[model samples]
Target: MDRSSQCDEPSSPAESPSPPAAHGENEKNAQFLTGLRLYGVLIGTSVASFLISLDTSVISTAIPSITTQFHSTPDITWYASAYPLTLCSLQPLSGKLTTIFSPRWTYQTFFIIFLLGSLLCGVAPNSSTFILGRAVAGAGGRLSLYSFGTILGPIMGGALTEKVGWRWCFYINLPAGAVTVATLFLFFHPPQKKPATPLTPREKLLQLDLLGCVLFTASIVMVLLALQWGGNQHPWNSPLIIALFTGFSITIIAFTIWEQRQGDSAMIPLSVLLRRSVLFSVLFASLLLSSFVIPVYYLPEWFQIVLGATPLQSGIYMLPSVISQLLGAIFSGVLAKRIPYYNPWFFLGSSLLCIASGLYTTFTVFSTPPAKWISFQILQGLGCGLAAQMPLLTVQATLITSPAQIPLGISLVLFAQYFGSSLAQSIGGAIFQNILASQLEQEAGLDKTQIQELLRAGNAKVRETVAESFPQSLNAVLEAYNMSIFRVFWFPVTGSAVAFILAGGIEWVDLRDMASSEGSENRVVDEFSKPGAKQGGSRAGV
Candidate 1:
């Protein structure tokens, strides 16, 4: 009944003999880096993480400019969604690749891919090309050291866009990526654990579960396309939209059946996913990220369009949110070591996020105070930061008995996080577009052509154009934009509330005790095997 059995696969004759227990322990200890070399690896990986995190957030402030240049305002959803879509879909494969190959080489391969994608985006001539580049970059990216880069991404993106051009936002990755690649090549000496069975290159490739990845990606794309096109490019009841949704349901069901049959080799191991701790954790991570991404994207638009702030100014305004999120993350991480139960932090964090999102929906075009908006942002960021990382920690804690399962468990949660962000952006964009169009038509009395012109002009040009030509309807137009954005805020408001409820479902495990017990792993296996053990119930004094 050992949990490790679920991760087992058939052995190969080419595999090397297993080392003695004592020798294996020594090998494990030898892998631990110390001194300056450890610091160098940290620096290298942290920079890589920064690049990945920066890519996600930097495009937020620059979206307005990109839409303006391309005159493809409707494509805003794809601009942000495309990267995360590929990142989410390809994440499990990346994890498997690192397992089959050396982490150092795998890391470099992904870095090169990311750099190429960045170059493509930097020189992209049109909206479609840019979105393609974003997807390419996303395929090559992985997650790590998130907060610092995320804090600087918006500000840096805005400065680069205004002072030079938005392309610089992507161009900046080349130099940074080169430094990361060199540092990793030189200092990253991860101890290689000999696989129980050595496989040929073809075998390793087959283990990637490419079909599962494709099916999963197709299903997600179907849903996103439906959301993006619904009520915007096509009617909600249109054939194309209906087909997309139908495809999503069918593909998702197929993906589930395939994964169940694939067993341990599945892209997402159903055995690990079925655990109560992991299931709730995955849900919480998805909802928390969805809530967080909505504000990160739309707040910049609100600042630029409604408040009349420049891109640089809008980025500056985001400082409160980003900085607060970092602080909240740090605080929760530190407290987690001292506090026994993680669920409390989850509860408090989700509560704060829900409240902050509700406050966001009350924002007005003219009367809302700077202090009000800033405080709400701080609250939202703090909540997101506090809860954002708990799911990973929860998975690691729950699967402590199965050391091999930890990586896969973490990957599943990470996939959910990015997938949620991707879906949120598409849904938010749809809401914003549909509501804005309707309000402009009814309240501002603008026709379809006029509305399209205003959208193509970009957020920065909206007020100016309205005042210049439609002076009589300028106030109404601004009001329409404000109302549309506020309506979009409701999505996160609902998301955060749902996350709060899911937080209660997280199993209560005392980390301090888990670390103290020498036989904790055996104890965990025993508890899991129990017939009537209530999932997520307290395990105190076990």
Candidate 2:
């Protein structure tokens, strides 16, 4: 085994070392952090994860305040979509950068970027600047606390919005991020594997595949722009919309071709992506996330606009879903660890989510019972939590034999998740805005100017104004909002159904056996320093 051969191609199963030899190699390769340092590192990473989750979930409740202050309802989608746009677009580049550079320094750099973006958002004077800040923050964001931060984000966002202002939502990250950065700098020291061959800085830069990143990012921007503008800011058949879609198609095709040609050096390696488990994982994750993200973004709006709840009230109202989701995730993890298969959980979760989404369409401006809405939230949350992490687990298990490919595999799945979220939010926003505008005009007799005014006035102002001025149309206005939100809910229903169907395609493996045998020769750590280490391998058996 020599370094040159290791870089050339992946080794086959027959070339793997024996179990005893592998155990010895694993011992030699393992890096352990003990005592206070280990605990410090764990706390640091957990706080960082919490910050990411907070950034993601905190904005939902504060969106109405932001829109009101900026008086730009048209830019609501951008507020939600912008962050995910850059997050997904630059995800691969971040991964490549970490591999090429020191992980600690790279992490610090990203943290600094995120902090700066947060500052920009906190001090933003307009919608455009705020959206730009979100995009910048997203480019540096990648981490989560599973469900704990999710449970607190809305509550904290609402409290800050009511007591201080919506700007505090971004400002809140500053102190927290500073502490997290300090903790990580002092305590976290990850083991880095040197490359098989030393390369110049130019060579390392080239490995980032900036062209592929540009093409992929361009393709995403084109489609998002089309979604944002079509039938909202511009006519669906307008030249700009048509051109955007056309560009997306062409750029995506070019990205695919380029990626194929690049082979292992590609941002998303075809050698890992084409596997049955990994491909299914990517699709399942994307669709499942779409189903989950729609409710996370829109449910607060439903509470605020349709039901006339304040921001703080809406955050409290979201507790059922968030708490249930956390419970479901913990339950699912426990069951999956004990069970031999995870496909059943996926099927069950998707079924619950599909049912919940369908049920959400039945909500109206009046006469919906608390028990019904509460139960619906629980069902949707439980469904999302149960299935959300299975795809990652599946990918990791499948790629255990090809350790070097694990990170790449995980990154692709995550990219799909974020990309799906961005696309879904844009589509959902478009659906809600377009339908609400049309329905308000037809049913409530509100003109475009009045509608814009009503949107800018905030929920409380809108209620007072409508009751005082258009008393007879107040019910109609609320109904229009309800109908529009219900229509948006249908997208999640479709997404959940598609995920249910895709669950059949996910190849199953006995995780129990895999865990038990992980220390054996089959579970090789494909280190770059090793001469004969396998970079990729055949798909894990079903």
Candidate 3:
């Protein structure tokens, strides 16, 4: 779908378009693309996003199977962690890549890379090979819409594993990705805008900040390595872990210095980071949006370990939260488009998210009432749904009239989200494992030797094997699982609290007016209504 509106010529004050009328009819029309081409592109985008996001959780359900097949126990976390590690590392670079090359070409290139990774994963003969494939896929699809992909992954993985095999999980991506690629190739081409300057080939390559990206990737990977191994593979105070942490800090500092010096050409441009909306949006995505990752990752474990539900059943149980989130986002989008004021919605969403996190913390092994967990999930999903896309939306609204800045704005928000999610997951895993280990020893009455063996056995096996072999200790083990998951809830609670505070700083942008030529001037309008305001008119300070 070549949905190219001629880049609106830079408008003079007197050349601005007519104000959008009541009902935001003009604004709605401006955003819509008619014809089958549009539909094809939209469908292709959704399918691509689904596969990308699904990768985040698909391997999770198949983790045990993969471990058993490969006879690898130590690197189980890497199956999941490897993808996001590369993803978070390269997402910002992908955004920059789009700017320097054709968005269509860049997207297709990544899609191809992702396909190869999936193929490798599907046919892998060992854990190392499989992890490598996941990392490759993660790097390629890092900029794809993974938030949505993850929502449906567990169920898809379970069903696929049950029907075909665990290998089919990665194999499934091949056909789906091929179909999406073909559709996109037939229909998708974003409107092209001439670059501000025609750069030499060398200049364009330099603009990508390859060195900075490598340094930053190294830094993040080091930190992730430390997190993954700490208190599990190695003692928290081990010199190797300490060195990794130190290397991360040093490398990150170097990357920051390089980026600051590189300025506009840097992978993450400093100028964009300096903008108020961009800065806040990054924070909101990192702290608030990423909080969603907690339950998405652990809730399945909760169901499997604590409640003894199968992976498919656990995925089904998660629908309340997932569906509510989808609905909340839709409702909020409608409200944002129709109403001029959106900060209140942001405020409401964050406040609700905080409340929901608090509610989930109350979950216990005995709290098996479906109603309670379902209600809690609904609340969390609704809260997340309302606010999930707001940060990026705000960034776009602010840059509506500045087409050139839109890509950077989006990339910044996504980087924050991916980075935050990866960080949270790593830390969350460390916390969960450490607590589970301690609880098994202290509360489950396991001797040190038994605890060590259990820790090595992994959560899924420990729960199943312990329940069968040690009936008296099963209750204690389940309780420990409950507590560990509960403690992880505090991270999101704290994150949402911070998000609520930061959300207050989001300047109000009316979607109705954002379609007009004067959007840039009015982007950061006040939230309150003006006196004697006309129905469906612009708000105060707009």
lDDT winner among the candidates? 1
Q: Over the stretch 1-542, how does candidate 2's per-residue lDDT look in tens digits?
A: 11111111122111222121344665686656788777776676666667766888889899988888887776778888888778778766765665667767777777778888889999999988999999888887743223257678889888888889989999988998887778777876655557668889999989998889899989988998898889988999999999999999999999999999999889778889999989988888888888887888788888888888888888898888888887787687767656888788879888899999999999988898889889998999888878877776677677777776766786777778778888888899889878988998998899878787777765435577688767788889999888988999999899999989999998878766676684622343434334223332111000
- Sort all candidates by TM-score, best to worst: 1, 2, 3
Model 1 spans > 4 angstroms off = 1-43, 143-147, 186-197, 511-516, 519-542
User: Residue 323: error of model 2 in Å?
Assistant: 1.1
Best of the candidates, TM-score: 1
Sort by lDDT, best first: 1, 2, 3
Write down the TM-score for model 2.
Answer: 0.88
**Residue clash pairs of candidate 1:** none
lDDT of 1 by residue, 1-542 (tens): 12422211111101111222354464454545678776777677767777877888898888888888888878888998998889888867765665567656766788788889999999999989999999989888752324357778899989988899999999999998888888778877655556667888899888999889999999998998898889989999999999999999999999999999999899989999999999999988888888888888899999988998888888999988887887787787777767887798788888898899899999988999999989998998889777776776688688888755665776788778878889999999899989999999998899988898898787667888788778888889989999999999999889989988988888898777787778765555544332211112100000
| lDDT at position 298, candidate 1 | 92
Question: What lDDT would candidate 1 get against the real structure?
Answer: 0.78
TM-score, model 1 to reference: 0.88
Instruction: Residues 357-436, candidate 3: write the lDDT tens digits.
Output: 88888888985699989998888888887876667667666665664565567667766776777787777777776787
- Which ten residues in a row are the worst by lDDT in model 3? 533-542
The residue pairs found clashing in candidate 2 are: none
Give all TM-scores, in the order shown: 0.88, 0.88, 0.81
lDDT of 2: 0.76
RMSD of each: 6.8, 6.7, 8.3
